[model samples]
Target: MLPNLDDIAPNMAGLTIFSILHAAPGFSQIPTQDESKLRTMFIAPFGRSCYAHVPVGICLGPEYFQTKMTECLKGREGCEAVMITQSSTKRH
Candidate 1:
């Protein structure tokens, strides 16, 4: 069952949280072995249907890391048509 967002943030919390897997630092920090492990854990199980329904957000980070993550997910067996969204923002 899903947790109640109202309990966490009465006015601002979203009801559901989407997962966006990203490299910790950059592409260099994510070795092939680690990338494969992440894929097996996050992407592989959900497959295409789930991923397609939940948009993947890629924002902030090294250009190479963002590129690599996009490429990896795009290459997944049932994720070839997955949609990727890019975002940018500043906080004070």
Candidate 2:
């Protein structure tokens, strides 16, 4: 589940945050060798929203998987400000 930013930081009431849940099976199982395919599959779904505005960050679940996802998102158009976050409170 995504963190309730409002509950954690009440001062962020005016901020606009977008949260994408990766609940689909094998969503994180895509092979690193198929980066193009991975980009196609992942970005297509959220391309419009991500590109609609700047300063977009893509948060992935499970801290360990973030490294791979970060590489995938980096260099992609409109993802210049992409920030990856693990779905937990513990610091990585």
Candidate 3:
């Protein structure tokens, strides 16, 4: 089950902060054994180039990232409470 922010600190003794992660930054943290799998040619105004990290447009990018993050948070209490689809947080 997911946590509802409305239920958090109903007495106003706590705080909630919202964070949004852009796909590119997270994807860069994941290394590919064969970088060629992540490669894609593109032509921008500056020039033509390819991505060194996983591209945001890839169909599996978001799911793959989410799985990795879930693995990282596995066994931690309140992990599921803080996870909202593509975004996740670890209390520290």
Candidate 4:
């Protein structure tokens, strides 16, 4: 089930290649005000004026919810994930 990453590293060639979903872009590698890639790539998915294709990208697994966006996010925030269900209840 996963595709090989061609034109890439040999060791990683056979492994599954997927996208990362980051919120707030975590500990800055470079200041975002200067238009750092860490800031741009994560924010890219939501905008129309800017040309980022992440909105239309594939839903490959391992949705990593970095420490900055734990409680507000699903998928165990950054740990393991289990299938859960919510059932409707009749109000008294």
Q: Roughly what TM-score does model 1 have, to 2 decimal places?
A: 0.21
Weakest lDDT window of 10 consecutive positions for candidate 3: 80-89
Compose the digit string of candidate 1's lDDT tens values, residues 1-92. Answer: 33355663654333343334444534435444443344433445657322211123323235546576677777564442332332322210
Candidate 2 lDDT tens digits, 1-92 = 44455665665444455345452332345433333333333345556322221111223324435555566677764443333344344531
Judged by lDDT against the true structure, how good is candidate 3? 0.63
lDDT winner: 3
Model 4 TM-score, all chains together: 0.19
Which parts of model 2 have CA positions greater than 4 angstroms off? 1-6, 9-11, 26-29, 32-92
For model 3, residues 1-92, the per-residue Cα lDDT tens digits are: 55466875463344354554444478887765465653666889999877766777778889988898778778874554342332224552
How well does model 2 score by local distance difference test?
0.41
User: Highest TM-score, which number?
Assistant: 3
Residue-wise C-alpha lDDT for candidate 4, range 1-65, written one tens digit per residue: 33335633454433443444443433332122334323335434665342232222223211422
Write the number of the candidate with greater lDDT, choosing between 2 and 3. Answer: 3
Score residue 52 of candidate 4 by CA lDDT.
Answer: 31
Model 4 clash pairs are none
Task: List the pairs of residues colliding in candidate 2.
Answer: none
The lDDT, on a scale of 0 to 1, for candidate 4 is 0.34
Clashes of each: 0, 0, 0, 0
Q: Rank the candidates by lDDT, best first.
A: 3, 1, 2, 4
